[model samples]
Target: MAISDIKRYTHLTDTDVEALSAELAGIRRAVTTSLGAADAAYIRRTIAFQRLLDVAARLTIYSTRSLAGQLLGATALGVAKSVENMEIGHNISHGQWDWMNDPEIHSRNWEWDMAGPSSQWRYSHNYRHHVFSNVVGMDEDLGYGVLRVTRDQPWRPEHLLQPVRNLLLAATFEWGIALHDLHAEQDRTGTTAEKSALSRALIRKLARQVSKDYLLFPALSGRRWRRTLTANLTANLLRNLWAYVVIFCGHFPDGAEKFTRAELENETPAEWYLRQMLGAANFRAGPVMAFLSGNLCYQIEHHLFPDLPSNRYARISTQIQALCEKYNLPYTTGSLARQYLLTLRTIHKLALPDRFLRATSNDAPETASEQKVRAIHETRGTDGRTPRRRHRTRKAKRQVPHGV
Candidate 1:
C-alpha cells in the first residue's frame, strides 16, 4: 500500500475514537485510585525486596572463588533485579503506581534508583514517544545515527551491514544505548564546551574506578585477575544477549512505517497515533514473558498509555484492539516468535544497500484493494467532537506533575 493510503486506512470513526479515549481515561482513574489506597503496602514490599536483592548480590560477589561463576551469579541476579526496576519498581516510581504520592519521592526513585540515567526514556518513551510516536525526530526508539531501528532515517552507505552492525551494537553497547539519553540531554542543555569538559571528567572518573575495582582490587586481594576478567565478560555477554533479543522483537519489522520530519509535521494527531500503531509491533503476552521482559510485549498499549502501570496492559489490549477495529485503525500485533522472525527479516532486508539506498520509491502505486480500505475511514474527522467526550482539557493534561 502507498504511504498515504496506509495513513488513511487507520483513521477511526468519531464514536470509536471517543469511546477509546474514554476507556483510557477510565483506566487511568481506576489505576490511580487503587494505587493510592495500596501505596503504603506497595512501598514497603518494594523497599524490602530491593534491600534483600542488594544484600544477596553483594554476598554472591564476595563469596565466590571462580570469578566466572561469581560473574554468572551476579549477572543473573542483576538481570532479575533490572527487570523489576524496569517494570514494577519503575512504574511505582513514575507515579504510574500511585498518582497521589509525594512527587519528590517519585522523581527521586525514577531518576536515581529504578530506571537509571536514561531520562530520554522518560521523555521519549513516556512523553514524546507515547504522545507523538512513530513520527521521525519524535520517538527516541529510532537509533540516533547509522543504526536503523526505524525506517525513517535515509539509508547511508554503512547501513549495508545493518543486521551485523545491529547485533554487535546491541551486544557491545546495550548499556551505552540505555544511557544515550543522558548524553543527549547534556547536549541539549549545555554548551558544547561545557558538555565536553563534563564528558572528559566523567570518563576519567569512570576509568579510574574501573581500574581500581576491576584491576587493582583483584591483584591486591590475591584474587585471580584473569579469571575475574573472563567471568565478567562472559556474564555481561549473556545478559546483554537476553536484553537485546527481548528488545529487538518489539519493533524493526517488515511492513513498519518510516517517515521524514516533513511527513510527521504534516500529520494530524489521529494520523500520528495510527502511525505508531502500524509502525510499532507487539509480542506474545503471558505472565512468564511479562516477568522476564518487564511487560514490554504490550508495547503499543504502553506507548498509548505510559502512565498506566504496564501490568494492566494485557487486560486492556482486547478492548483497545476492538476500538481500533471499529475505527478501521491498524493494531499491529503478533506472537513473540513470529514478531522476532519478522524483525530479523527486516534487519536482513535493511542490511542490503539497494533496498533503502535510494529515496524509498512509492511502493508501486497502491492497488485497488488498498483504495477500498482507505475509502472506508476517510470521511471521519473532529467535527463530531462532543462536550462529554472531547479531548481532555489542556489543564487536565498539564495537571500531571512535572516529573511525571
Candidate 2:
C-alpha cells in the first residue's frame, strides 16, 4: 500500500514538480557556494569542544567520589559520545566537509568513536539508506530489520516482541548497527580472504572501542577502577539511547511515508526530492537541542541535501518550509516527544497482524498510498461516479541525473 505515483498522490502536475525541483536545486547551489571559512571554523570548534569535554568527563569520573559528580561526569561523557557519533562522525562520513580537503576531517580518513567501522557505516548509511530513504523492501532502515514499521512489510509472530526489542535496540544501538553492517559485509564478501579481512576490520574496531572505554580508562583510574568502569558503561548506554531516539524520531514518526519500488520507475530528481520531503519527519529543536541531535531534527533537509553542512540545515529548513507552503504540501514535523510517541505507537501497533487493525492498509497512519489522499476529495453524486480532479497520470521526464 506504499505510494507508487508520487505525482498522483500529491496531486501535483509535471510542471509543478519540475519547477519545485529547480527551486530546491537553487537552494543547494546557494548553500554549496556559500561554504567557506565560517563553516570550517564551526566544524573545527565543535571537534575541539567534544575532545575537551570527553577528557574532562573521563577525569572527573576517575577522580571524583561524589554521586553528583559521577552523574555529571557520566552525562557529559555521554553527550560527547553522542556529538562525536552523530554530528561529527555522521556528517563527516557523509562527505559534508570534504571541500575542506583536511585529511584529519575527510570522510575517507575520519574513523568514528563507535563499535561499527565508519567506513562500512558510510557505505551502508549514505548510499543504501539515504538513497533508498523509506522505500519498502529497499530501505533496510525501516524498523532496522526488526520491527514492522509499516503495513506493506508483512506481520510476523516474532514482531510481537518488537516493543521489547525496541528497548534493547535503544540500549545497544551502536552494537545493533555494527552487527547489521557486519551481516551485509559478510554477505557481500564471497572469497574467504575477503571475509577474513572484513572480520578483522570489525574486530579491530571492536577492540579499539572496548579497550578504550573498559580496559584503558578503568586501569588508568587505578584505585577508582570500579567507578571509571561504571561511568563508561553508563555513558555508552546513554549515548546509545539518545542516538536511537533521534534516529527514530526523524524516521518512523507519522507522515514519514513508505513507498513502493514502483515509485522509482523513471523517478525524477523532483520525485526523489518529494519523496525525501514526504518520507522524513522533523521535530522542533532549538540551537542546543538541535546540536545535540546532530541537526537531525531537520531530517527532511538532511535527506534533501545529504552532503550539505549540518549547521546550514536550519536556514535550509525555512526555505524548504516556504516551498512546501507554496506547493500546498504538508511539511511534517512535531515536538520531539510527539514524534517519538508516534513512532512508538507505530512499533507497538504494527507488532500484530492486520486482523486486529481497523484502518485500511492504504489509509493507515503508518502506511498510505495515492488512494488514501485521493479519497479525501472524492465526491460521488447520485450517478455513483466520483468526480475527478485535474491531475497528471504519466511519469515525468527522467532528465535529472540519478544520485549515487
Model 1: residues with Cα > 4 Å off, grouped in runs:
1-7, 14-16, 37-47, 61-75, 88-105, 109-116, 120-128, 149-152, 197-232, 254-256, 259-276, 355-404
TM-score of each: 0.71, 0.93
Can you write out model 1's per-residue Cα lDDT over 313-334, one digit (the tens) per residue?
7776776666654453445556
Best by lDDT: 2
RMSD of each: 8.7, 5.6
Tens digits of per-residue lDDT, candidate 2, 285-384, equal 8999999999999999999999999999999999998887667566778888888998999999999999999997976877767777656545422234
lDDT of each: 0.53, 0.86
With a 3 Å backbone cut-off (N, CA, C), the pairs that clash in candidate 2 are: none
TM-score, candidate 2, is: 0.93
Error of 1 at 344 (Å): 1.9
